[model samples]
Target: MARRGKTAAKSNPSRSDCSSTSNSLSRRPSSGDVKTDLLQALSAIAAQHVNAGSIPLAAALQADLKDVLRRWKQEHASDLQKNDKYVYPLEGRYDAGESSIENVARSSRDPRIDISLEVGNLSGADEAVVRALQSICNELGFAIFLASVERARKTLDEEVLDEAVRLVRVFLLDGGRVAEHVVLSPSEILGLQHLLPRKLIIYEWAAAISALEGQGQEEVPAELSAWIELQLLELFGQVPKLYVEDGPALATVLTPRRLKDIVSVMEKFAGTTPALISFLLAIHSKEMPISEETRQAAFKAVFATMLASFDITQDPKDVRMKANEQPYRPRSLDPPPKPPRIPCLDSDSLVQLTMHVIEDDTLRHELSLFTSQLGAQTTRINPLDFESLFLPFLHSLALKTTITEPHHEDLRTLFATTITAYHDRFVGPTPPIPPSEPDVADGSRRWVRPPVRCTCAANCAPLNAFLADARRHRIEFAVGRQRRAHLHQMLDATPRTECTHRTLRGGSPEALVVTKIDWDAVHKRNVRAAWEGRLKSFGGWMEKLVGAGVDLRAVLGLEEYERVVERREEEAPEEGAKDGRAVAAAAGELRKRKASEALVRSSRLQNAEGAGRDVRRRVAETVAVVDLTDD
Candidate 1:
């Protein structure tokens, strides 16, 4: 869904995508004289970026910026000369004393600093303008910093070989209808990546993303947001060399009192970007060892991060590594842990609750998915597993749906991810399909997808019913690469049971609707074997029995059966009367046979039952087998 470098560019600015990632979403900033506060925040961001990268200036270009400054000063001299007392006051770059950041943190409505300095007292016009210009510079790298300014942009546009300028001036500080600055589009940004330092663009946009995330909006270009988060973490991983060099500046701009809050917020935030997550943790935890509780989580996260990176969760080496690590650690509590719930899920309870899945008409795929994940450890799901797995999965699932709307495409994805997340504790690692592969068939064959969604159709009931049957019957998915190879050695591996149904297709009298056998499994296991040897021409043998004066109509009477079967336009439902038709006919035969006749019939029944359940208990088994249905 997202690539590393390109993500930020693809956040389609045209769509009204919510870009807010406010750390404190519920708490909104109140309206008032927030002018100074807004200015301070803006100034801090601007300074961080301005101080970040190379100020591109060749001898000629340096002279050009100076020339512009000289001309602007000259042009505005009349205005500057007139406003000697109070106009065009050169603002000073903020000097952060020990308590300056602290004081800023505690700022109420009015900031203590005097904003209206006399223009005459203002010493450095170039410096004040440069500092003010930092916000724009932070936004625009110095490589093209002056290109968008009124005079410079006009000059640059004439010779314009470039598709766009790095910065676009929406309006100017000229007191008319002008925007101070606007960021370039992604395409424009990429064009300039080589021209400007990557950090300049990274830090500038990172600050914007961080600030926007603080604004309580969601639904931005997910790829872009995710990329920024990851890159922040990536840079985080490289903390000391790049970021630590700015610690003093950070301390000055952010404040000592704000450290705890910053760290706390970052601790939670870094989880979004694993690249920086480890370093964020290491930076904070370098001095203080992680608590036992946090350690387990850290391991799981790091392990999953590694798995994601290498795509090797199922490797034997990984399993051994996981085995060595402690899986659970108790969290510290004010009081203590609560007593565990009792009345473990009984077989009857699981069965009874499971029936709802088979019978219910109202449940959605989300419910189906959630229910399936909850029972992963035990097909006959423990009710406690519902509380443990599904309940928590539902919470995240709900958050992903409502909070992270665009990401929650399938319910099964939520379920599969939940199962994978807790794989160590709850569902032991089974044959985990790759995160890239489909765990379930979307009902249609697909090679791979994110874990949760398997085969899916519009409706879930039949699928739900099928899964329930698999659960009840203890259908083990062949585990490991050798599972297929091992199948021949397991049990008779031959069909013993009679099928429960005979299915006829819609609009065709001769179509076999349902095989009554797990043909998909059978075909994969050994298709040729099904028709090989003794099982071949079992149909012809059945006809021979009927032709040899063995009155099959007496046992499988054409009258009642014809009347019952003809009463439908479409095929009968699963587990309908037809499901048990083969068994009914076979039983009928047994009942009619006398002891001596039964002994003689044993070999045939035994032979047929051994081939396939469908062959014996269903239409394929019976002498009166119909090739197709007339709808």
Candidate 2:
């Protein structure tokens, strides 16, 4: 019986052995099934931690999840060999209608996984939470970041706003994965505009947009471009206010290209004229980087606006008077007056703006256009406004060293027109010429006194007549002490005259004697010297602006130039003056140098003539000798 049982066992195993074999077969799992099970457990654990506000723990598990996914991908590489499908976790479900197990089985070939979490109240969240959020975002994708931004936008909390800005910046700096995932549409950006804090807009939002545009990842839609334009306009509108609030901070925000972009937008959009002018004016003297093209556009816009707003008939003096008059004050307090329709820039501001316009080489053509237009209206411009605005502008342009040669003709025309319109200011009424000195009978020197007229009621008519006579140099007013004191006061105030108090021999009322010296010549020489100095200084500037080819005297009008510039050459030396002596010495030295130069030239000419004559004679003699040899 035992041998028969052994044979049977060998032929077919017992029930226990069959059960063990079946159990082993049932318990053994395939590699695909093992990967599915591991992913399911990880998803469940991550969900549990997220729900329980254990984000740090969930974030920590991301590494293990990634590892399992990687190994699964490596083992069953063919299974995950489909198009990129994001494994979005929904209650541990992969997608709608698919079980987690089925999705995990499919995910063997899908390497991309994105997790969307709803952790409430991130406003006061700890740094660890933020860090974990960042980690999840980096591992997963931009969907996570978009979800956070939406949450923060809804909350509108300051802390939430900051966190959202920080997250978006970090994501964008990571090469703008969001833009890659989607087109980064304008609607999406515009929707988030309000959520972004103004203080952080330049640093975060603008920087991100700049980066995206710079990368040229995708074509920017028209709507998106328009949206960018509108946002830039709004930001430029706030530039003045921003500068007033925090100038240095605002200065640091803009780069040259960024500023150029803003100005270009302003140029494209109409009715942004005021904002453009204000923005340029506000950033005028700052160290902010601005391109020449931008400055030209801004200045052109400003000039166009100013020309449009100009009223030739409206006198600026009258406007100023009206402005100075106090507004009607009702018994009740009134609202503030509306700002001027045109920007009322002060003289200094206008000067700075003009300088910026003139110094930019690119604006040469535009400047010519503006100056031509300005010159046409020069006569009609209110004198007060011309002096306050245009005159200073011209002065700044004149002084600017960067002005190139191309602008010279326009500047000359503008100056010529201005000089004609405002002749008195440029060339005043002719100054009075000093009278000649009188002939002295005793061979004593004398000078004619300037005429003096007083409205005092006294018998000083004699003294006045004597002072008015050019041939007489001495005058005496003999009167009471009070009258003599009055005469002394008048003579003391008068220029180029000396006064002496003399008591008559018999105590006759004290006499006030006045003698005019040759100080008038000295005074005239000093005035001429100062005028010459100014002319030389102005001539140097003209040389820079108009170049050497264009005659400055013609541009200035010959009469005015000769009076202001050339008159110094014709000045005569005053007698008994050190300045006169110096001038005479200089003239003598100049004449001597000229004479020596002429003598040297004459000597060189004579020596050349003599050598020519000698050469001719030698040649004739050689010809004669050749003829004799032939004979």
Candidate 3:
């Protein structure tokens, strides 16, 4: 009976044992339990590998560890949300000699990993490791910020945007490393277009584009290049405002090389002319101190793109007519013809752009860039166009006396060439006008009457006509008091003219009697004198431009030199001869006055000696008186 009872007890479990088995089967593993199991499994795997450097085994182990970590994070997501202070279990092992945190930090895009752990665990990190971790943090922070910006599309959260901007500023200011980790999509850039700081955009986008250095345009996706160009255009529009806001900070990021990079990127896409122009103008602004090399590069890119739209060798008039012609309408069944390529620059824009290029002191010196761009097509540039554009630029050069000596020779050459071109094209084979003597009446001593310049409709025209006739010397205008006063004022302004107002006894308007007095001789003399003064002034100006002793003929060209300088020189002698008698008479008068002054001095000397004798005699008498008194 005892044996049977013991068998039953062994076969049928106790109530407590049954309850323990059911609980063990039904209960889930806690986070602590899973973590302990994961650690034990990882330890066992590590212990089994005698060769710790076995690549296959290490790879398998890493794969398993990643899978386990991923599942654990997913399963324990609720727990993770509850605990904000949870640290990654493998955080310490990341920077261990056995593992490289740099690779993981660089390759990982998982936002679930607490990046703050890597950021805070920099106590004994190597410099490279620290930079890698910092780069990772920056990338992650930027990603989060971008997410917020994306979310902002639906709901405009000012707080989120502000915080995002602050975080982005930190990432951007950290270094260029962040750019390597995160590539901004077109949509991302477009989304943050208005929101992102321009300096930050410039730095990151510029760096990203620069990273694709060796890749060909074909290798780069067209959409990306297009967006990049659009982005650049948008940025260029904000240049003035951004420059004001960022000041010198903008310059540090959008450097000359960066500008070249941007231009190169734009060149890949079609119809980049307007944006390129804006870019050119932006860099050319007083704010941006772009280097000459970069400026030229930008100019080359812009002009090349601009010129591609039209045949520069064609006549501008023809081009204008063609451009203004109505578009060709197609039949309903006809395939749509290719759209006409619109010229990037019109005549006015081209002229204005050329003026700007010419205005830049540095750029003007290197006009080979301008000429080289025009290439052989320069012959087709209309003379009218030339006059409209280069003539004004040449005239401006005359006013630009502040040009330094280093640029003088180049400018002098440009000045000479332009003047020659203008003379040959516009002035046309006409002989240089010799200096003319003032017109004089055939038998009269008085000169030809000069024209009155007054424009008043009342009495000035008749008076001017009368004065203009060389034969007529005097004219009387019977007019009112006010009319006579106006006549007198006009006569006063006119050279070598006289006017008198006479009141009639019968209450008539005063007679304004106008007459010429030595008009021709006085006018000619004054004209020659003015020419001499202008010659001297112009000679001095030329010297200032090309340095002292530079030949005016060489700088001003043969025609201009002879017309301006030689003619003045030839007329100078005649002017001197006309003044010679007046000069001689003045010298003679000076000599006569000197002789009279000498005679007066001699007479005064004699008188002084006689006075000296009388004074001596008085002194002797006084001395004798004084001696007698003292005794």
lDDT for each candidate structure:
0.30, 0.41, 0.39
- How would you encode candidate 3's per-residue C-alpha lDDT over 412-481 as one tens digit per residue? 6655655445444443332222234433445453434665678677889888777666666667788887
Model 3: how far residue 549 lies from native, Å: 6.3
Candidate 1 lDDT, 1-631, residue by residue in tens: 0001211111111110001111222322323322222223223323333453333322332222233223333433555432111011112322223223434454333354222111122223323333333333233222112112110111101211122223322211211223333434322232222222234322232333333332222344675456555554444444322121121112111223333433433343332222222222332333323344553443334323323332111222222221233446577656555555432222232333323332444434434553443334333334345444343334433332332233333433433333333322332212211122112333332211121122334222332344334223222232233432333222223243222222233432322111124434434334333222212233343344333322222222333222221111122222212347775666565556544554654566567533222323433333232222211
Question: Candidate 2: which pairs clash?
Answer: 80-109
Assess every candidate by TM-score: 0.18, 0.29, 0.26
Q: Model 2 scores what on Cα lDDT?
A: 0.41
| Residue 61 shift from truth in candidate 3, angstroms | 50
- For residue 604, model 3's alpha carbon misses the true position, in angstroms, by 55
For model 2, how does the per-residue alpha-carbon lDDT over 497-612 read when each residue is reduced to its tens digit? 54343545445776666665556555765565544443343434333334323343456654554343333222344343447678778788867876686587468656763322
Model 3: lDDT of residue 310: 26
Cα lDDT, model 2, residue 395? 59
